[model samples]
Target chain A: MSTIPAELRFAESHEWARQEGDLIVVGISDHAQEALGDVVFVELPEVGKVFAAAGDQAGVVESVKAASDIYSPVAGEVVEVNEALADGPEALNEAPYDSWIFKVKPANAADLGKLLDAAGYKALIGE
Target chain B: MGQRTPLFDLHLALGAKLVDFGGWDMPLHYGSQVEEHHQVRRDCGIFDVSHMHVLDVSGSQAKPWLQHLLANDVGRLQQTGQALYSAMLDTHGGIVDDMIVYQTDEGYRLVVNAATGDKDLAWMNANLAGYDVRIKHRSELAMLAIQGPNARQKIGELVNQERTALIHTLRPFEGQQEGEWFIARTGYTGEDGLEIILPATEACAFFNDMVGAGISPIGLGARDTLRLEAGMNLYGQEIDEQVSPLTSNMAWTVAWMPEDRTFIGRAALEAERVRGITSKLVGLVLEERGVLRAHQVVRIAEVGEGEITSGSFSPTLSKSIALARVPMATADRAEVEIRGKWYPVRVVRPAFVRHGKALI
Candidate 1:
């Protein structure tokens, strides 16, 4: 089982987010990082990018194994991007929830209700 | 539905992330894939290759039958335990599968992929009707690949000294039996190592024993990268039923001797040789700071466009590399388009890293 923090919520696609004031800081889940093996490159969403809720292919993460798409968990506008990932993409693997791919100001803050809490996400993966 | 290997339980115990690969439920990685890849390159690593198919072909007509069935002349295997890598092809010279044929005292043994076993067996059986050879699939056996430069040393430390001596002196592509285990000094990682084949029931125990001996457990993720770095082609990606060995960069595997030798795809391959192949497979190293990926376009000034068959970030080189099928006229250097940006790349022969050292 992944070391998911209780303070964060997870999307079914494996993106993890934590609510902070008006912004929701998002990255991949611990399980997602482990599943991706070693992340070598990350194609993150640029600042000011608009995102739709659920299943929207927001970006891409390429590992030594294969490339996969990162999906959006909720409707939002990108407010901040983690530029550190450009050089140290493996940081996401080392510390997924803390890596923080991008911060988004949720268009509908209530959409967080649809996402899974740490306990619910653990059950979702049958952990 | 998905199938499982004999070591499926062992992989689960090790916390491997399971994935469906060609209908088989296989481990993509045991927690971390990069570490597994590095283990094979630096130290010793073990891979559960039980999902690969092993078949035995015997009888007096074995030599003659295999000679006609395979693209390479199997009769060239004179010494017992000598191995030959060849392509089983259709009449049109399309590769059915690439396999390693080992000459045993009884007859010949072939280790092929599990996914292609049925088709390969049926194809071989159809042609062996006239011959006296009998083909038998060995699903009861499990295979383990232990690779790296320190592999034999570690294996020597684990097994008894008597078996250790035998394994240490074993030539590449040669296998010898010690009790129920068959150890071969052959592997796909382009490193010095041994591939051990034993009874299915004993697979988990053997895997645990080897891991206890400090052999890292690797998965399909590292397996793919290791093979790619070694310039070894994947069956489905590099060569398939629609692609011939000529275009697949496996022409060296084809035997063109004794002009009279009539293998399954002999005529078509001979014609292709005479007519000249239009496309060729080559290795690409990205000169820029972008990852090379499959299906990316290769643009050349004089030569035509080519496509990347397999591409990834090479852990050994710390750069993006790929295997591409390009026009025969393509230059040694070309540009690869990645997300609207063209990056300079150089074409080089593979086996980029061997024996824990970068070759280029």
Candidate 2:
């Protein structure tokens, strides 16, 4: 079973969002990382980029096998992008939950409620 | 449920990630694909290759039959146990499949791709007219490859003294049968190794013994990367039925001498040479952070565009590399379009690494 922290919210596409004050820290779930074995490269969204709605293309995660698109869980503007991932993409596989990909300033913080909660994500992934 | 190899249960017990590969449930990886690739380069690793189709050809006319059936000449195998790589081409000069053919005292043995087994057999049978040849499909056998710089030394320790002496004496591209086992010093990975074809019943026990002796079991994921790094072509990716061996970096495998010996696709290949070859396969190295994938458009400055056939993040090079078919005039530099942006890449000879050393 994958780790689904009760405090975080998840998208059906496997991204997780945690509210840290007005900004939301976003990363992929543990389940997502495991499915994508050994992340070799991560294409993080640029800062100040605007996502008009949830489930928009935020970045890309590439493994040796294939590449997967990462989606934004909520409508937001990119506040800060993870720079460390540019040099050490394996960090996504080693610590998926703790290694946040980007920080987003949500246009509407209420959009987080529309995403799946921890228990809902667990059920969605068939934990 | 797809077709299972003799080592299917053993793979499951080793916690392999199974995937569907040409109607066979094969292990994609045991845990980490990159690790397995490095293991084969730095140390020894074992692979289950029992899914490949093995066939034996024997008869009074077997020599002439193969000389006409394959692009490479069988006459080159001057000594018994010598092996040669050849391309099986269709009438249009397109590659039907590429395989390795070995000569034995009795006759010749061929190992072909599993996915193209039915088609290859049909083609071989269709061209058997007026030839006194008998083809026997050996489905009851299993194949394994143990590869690395230390592969020979480690495998030598496992077998008996006679087989061990054979392992020491077996020259590269040579295979000989010892009792029920046929061991050859040949491998797809660009490393020193042995490819053993043995009875299916003994596969499980032998695999267990190797693993118990501390050889890492590699999966198909690493196999692709290792071959790619070695500049080897995959059947569907680099050379399909629509593509000719001349454009797929396999022109060396085509035997053009002995002009009287006409092979199946010889006429078409000669015509193609006369008409002029347009596109050629080359290697692309992306020094940037993103990965290169198949079907990505490759653009040359003043030349025509081409496409990447096989692309991946090279574990050995620590960079994205690909085998691409580009315009014949493509020079030392090219650009590959990833996502919506164009990234510059360096074009080099198809090979990136060999014998655990970076070639480019």
Candidate 3:
């Protein structure tokens, strides 16, 4: 079983987002980490990088088995990244909840309602 | 429906990530594929290869029968327990399946993939209509391959000395049985290890004992990477009915001697050899940041284009590498197109890394 926090919202692609006041903390879900196998390296979006909501390709993470793109959940300007991931990419595999990739300022604050909650995410995974 | 190996429950208990591989529910990785690859290269790891099919062909005329059926010679296996790797070819000389034949005192034992069981058996039966050989599929058996430099040492500690005494003298491509377990020195990974074939009911216990003995349970992801590093060819990817062994760097496995052997596809291979093979399989090491993936186009400067058959990031080399089939006239360097970017790479013989060290 995966450890899921109640406050964070999840996307169907298995990314989790938490509202930190006006900023949103984004990272991968436990299900995503388990599916990607062992993470070897991470390519995170640069600090202060602005991305559009619909087609935002924030960055990429290369796992031992395959590579996956990290999509932005909402339009935002990156403020900071989990620099610790550069040296310890497996931290995402170990703790997806706390290992947030970046912080973003949502373009539309109300867009958070579109993301899935704990129950919706669980149902999406056929749990 | 997904197929399951005898050790499927054990894999689940160990927290392996299961995936569909060739229609079988096999483990892709336990936790870390990179770590599993390193375990096999640096130390020891065990894989549940029970999904592979095991068959026994016996009778007085088994030798002559096999020589007539397979592309390789079986008479060359004069000693008991000696093994021979060969390709089962169609009448057109295209490979149907690649298999390992073990010479037992009573007859010959073969290990093939489960997917090719019906087709291979049908071919063997149709070819041996008048021969005295009998084929028996041992689907009730399970196989485990414990591979690495330290594999023998770990197994040696677990089993009784008296049981493994005969294993020490067993050479490469040879094996012997101790009680109910048949242990073979032959392995797909280019390292010292044992492939143990035992009854399916005992598979769970053996897996548990091995895991308890500190042998890490590896999945098919590392299996692919390890075999690629060892320069071994995988079925469907390297060679199949669509491709011949000659172009897949498996010419050595083909027996060309004993002109009168009259095996299947002998004449075609001979003609192919005489005509000269146009394409040859070679190894490539990526010089850039991206991972090497299959189906990528390879440009051999001034020579011709090739395609990557198998590619992955070598855990030991800390870079991407691949096996590509390029023109025989290709030079020592090539370029691989990854995501539209051509990266300069060195073309060399396979075996990019072995025994936990980089060989490039």
Candidate 4:
């Protein structure tokens, strides 16, 4: 019974994106966090690391159970990384929506529309 | 469909995430796996280990029958309720299974791993030609492992007066029977705790009572991490049908005394000892942020390639640790490959933490 916020756009891989000015803030969805169990470590991309649309290994999020790759929602260059998660990885488990992993400046702004909306994301997770 | 344990409904009610383990549907975690791990280390937690097989071997030749069945000599268990941990092996010195044998007045009771139940029972039955022992599977029973530093004090408030006195006098690696309940001072988590075997009919009530008393319901996820931190071997991982005790750091569990006495795998083990064991199990600690997982390759430069058997994030130390079987000549340093890149790891004794303290 994980919450899929109506505002946030999502990827099939379980990462969610929210538009924040020129850059979009991204984090794992509630379903992703629940499936990964308690996160013990998070490996975020460097500040300027760029990602492609379909094939990019954005970063790593590791729970006590397993480590999963967080893929990019759309092609973008990482503008900012969440440094607080390095010390307290549990933040993502506590609130997956609020604890953004990294902010990405999209390579093509239209790519955001191609991503799954709230209804589509809910359908993807079978919620 | 997988089988269900007696506590299956209770787990669902507690919001446990159930997974298929071996043929049984069991809990992976109640909610947060890390919280359960910390609870067992810092406070108290209980695990429904009823999936494990319990057998009663009775009759005239029970002692001599077990002597040949297990690698460890059970003759030393002269005192009542004394338990012995031993490995049942095949003729080729391969591990069949590992179990705990407790000597009770009626006969000897053995508790073995759940995944290896059928195979183990088949092996036992195949070797019963000369012995007068009856191997009875106690299907009507359920077991729970109540563990942690404060486990004893918490459980004391729940049981009756006689069982309370019995709990107080219970020593490590021992069991005391009272009516239908058998409480043993043994645990896989390397903590002071009890593994209780009681009638299955009363398991739900007992579980409810313990939870009502604030004992957190633990799942197999934390059970695994706790045992991994304690450096205990998992059946299919560290010591399996193909893995020998000589290389698995379980040679101590095999008794070589009374030279005349021969066990199932003794001959092959003795031959292996003479030839010298090549690969050995050791502990690996990754101080950095990466998580160590099973089957990851370990590169020891001069000693050839080895792999991590079992590994996890150690909640107590907040670092990743693992048990890797490396070359006999390997010492100190090794590198583990994760994804495509290799990272350096330090090798030490197989144990990481025990008794709620960091051993590394």
Q: What is the DockQ of each candidate?
A: 0.61, 0.93, 0.47, 0.79
User: Native-contact fraction for each model?
Assistant: 0.65, 1.00, 0.45, 0.75
lDDT for residue B88 in candidate 1, whole number 0-100? 95
TM-score of 4: 0.97
Quote the lDDT for B338 in model 3: 71
lDDT, model 4, position A82: 95
Q: For this target, which candidate reaches the highest lDDT against the unseen true structure?
A: 2
lDDT of 2 by residue, B1-360 (tens): 999999999999999999888889999999899999999999999999999999999999999999999999999999789999999998999999999999988899999998999999999999999999999999999999999999989999998888899999999989999889999999989999999999999889988988999999999999999999999999889988898889888899999999999998999999999999988999999988889999999999999899999999999999999999998899899999999899999999999999999999
Best by TM-score: 2
Q: Flag regions of model 3 displaced more than 4 Å.
A: A19-25, A43-57, A76-88, A100-106
lDDT per residue, candidate 1, B125-212, as tens digits?
Answer: 7787779988888899999999998999988887777789889789988987777777889999889999888899988887898899
Scanning candidate 1 chain B in windows of ten residues, the lowest lDDT window is B350-359
Between the candidate structures 1 and 2, which one is better when assessed by TM-score?
A: 2
- Using Cα atoms with residue i matched to residue i, what is each candidate's TM-score against the true structure? 0.92, 0.98, 0.92, 0.97
lDDT of 3: 0.86
Order of candidates by lDDT, top first? 2, 4, 1, 3
lDDT tens readout by residue for model 3, B1-360: 689998898899999989887778999999889899888888899999998989999997898999998888888898778888999888767898999999887798999976777888888888987889888999899999999999888888788786567667667778777777888998877788899999999999988999998899999999998899888889878888988888988888888788788888888887888899989899999876667778999998789899999988777787788999999998988999975778899999887776666788
For residues A70-103, could you state the per-residue lDDT of candidate 4 as single tens digits? 9988898999999999999999989899999999
Clashing residue pairs in all predictions, respectively, total: 0, 0, 0, 0
